[model samples]
Structures are given as C-alpha cells and as structure tokens.
Target: MYRAGGTVTGERDAQPGVSRVRRLGTHLPPVARAPGEARAFVADALRSWHVPEDKACDIVLAASELVTNAFEHGSGGIALRMRFTGDCLLLEVRDSDPGDPVLHRPGPRSVRGRGLALIQALSSAWGHRRGGDGKWVWAEFQLA
Candidate 1:
C-alpha cells in the first residue's frame, strides 16, 4: 500500500502575492496501475482542499500523465506532490530516472508521444528539474 501525507497551513510565498499554501504528497510503486492510483490520489487531495470539480479534473489528468511517464520511463521509485497557494495549484511527480521529460508534437496518425503535449495544453506552465535521487516533472494550474 502507498503512504500519503498532507498539511493545511497558512503560509506565505516569497513571491509578491501568494499566500495560504497547502500541501499533499504520496509515494507510489512503479507499476502498471500507477497512473490510475495517481489520479485517485490527486482527486482525493483536490476534494479535501475544496477545489472546483473542473479544476480538479484537469489537475488529475495532468497527474495521470506525469505518473504514466514515470512508470514507463523511470526507475527506482515514484513520488507525487501537490501544492496549492492562493490562485495556483502545482503538481509534481518525481522518479528515480534523471532523464528530462520531452514535449513532443506528434502527427495525426501517431499513437504515442502526446502525454506531455496534453499536459502542456491543460497546465498554465510545466517543466522538469533534477532533484534528490531523481528528477521532478511539474505542472502548474491557475485556480483564479
């Protein structure tokens, strides 16, 4: 079973206008069902935070894409984290692999390579970075 943790706090961001941040996280096994598990985890978190259904759906989709990429291409372990501050929600997925996620533009007939593209379309901003024992691919959504 996976372990989940969270904290609701009134914190301030270093940026000029962000405040009242909340955080949630979970660790998942690298398996075929990781994407579905990620979706559930994110859905629960968003629900607990009282996020709107439409926004929650978008975040869940982004989380699923990130988790699927990690399961398919990464090694070691997988972890997901989310942060909500003011009008922004951030989703991050970390895996043992250090390779960066590539955004591909596939042709109409292509069956694959569209996960990152979908994430890009759904998220306000998205990127990846090396951290700890692996790398984290993150997507941000505007809540306001």
Candidate 2:
C-alpha cells in the first residue's frame, strides 16, 4: 500500500472483464555509453515475433528518446521495458532521477526540449513513477 496526502492507496484492481498485465519492467545499467545500445535493447526485446521491421523501428525511436533522457538528465543509465495489453504497447524508461520530467509544448521555431512532448503525442498514454533512487517515464502506443 502507498500513502499519499494522508490516504492509503491499494494495489490496482482488475476490472471484472479485463485480463491484462498493466505493468512491464527492466533493470538497465546506470549509464549506456551509446544511447543506440539502449535503443537496440528495447527494439530487440520487444520486436515483433511476426512484424519485426515496423515494430522494431517504432521501439527504436521511442527508446532513443527515453535513453537519451536518462543519459542527459538522469543520474544513472536507463531501465527500459515494454508490455503488451490487447493491442497496446507500453514502453517504460526508468532512471536514477528522483525528480519527474517536465513535459512542455514548445513553439514551432523552438530548436529543442520537446522530446517528451513528442512521446506524449505519439503514444496512446504515458506517465511516470518516482522510486527511492530514481524516476520512471513511460509511454503506451497502440499497434495497428
């Protein structure tokens, strides 16, 4: 149980008709010398058993953004994972940053600082969790 705002929180309750795994996880190194390596890890792990190219490409892009975030801002390397619930894939990136990421909408001419926003727009859903030594940022995308 988790307590916040003086209230205790219970574990997630599965819906009566839903059979789903809402969580996925991985424990990655604190620092990846090359973000591409991290991207490859996610791409390979979550690649389609049948549709390798398309899924691998998407995972690579998202993973690149996530691992970059960890390498650039977080204290340690990224821990990445993905889950398949129905037709959705949730990609999670965990890092050693206690503070959550701040996503923003940048102006059209802005040259940087919009990666998370892009992730948010591309994915079906996304969020983060704070851990004792770090934070996790996750995004969910639907498979067509």
C-alpha RMSD by candidate, in order: 4.8, 9.4
Check candidate 2 and list the clashing pairs: 30-76, 30-77, 31-77
lDDT tens string, model 1, 1-144?
223332222344567774433776777888888898888778877886779999999999999999999999988668888888748999999988887788999999999999999999999999999998789999999999
On a 0 to 1 TM-score scale, where does candidate 1 land against the true structure? 0.84
- Residues 38-77 of candidate 2 have per-residue lDDT tens digits of 6655554454323346655766687788878887888665
Model 2, residue 128: distance off in Å is 0.7
Model 2 sits at a Cα RMSD from the real structure of: 9.4
Q: List TM-score per model, in order.
A: 0.84, 0.70
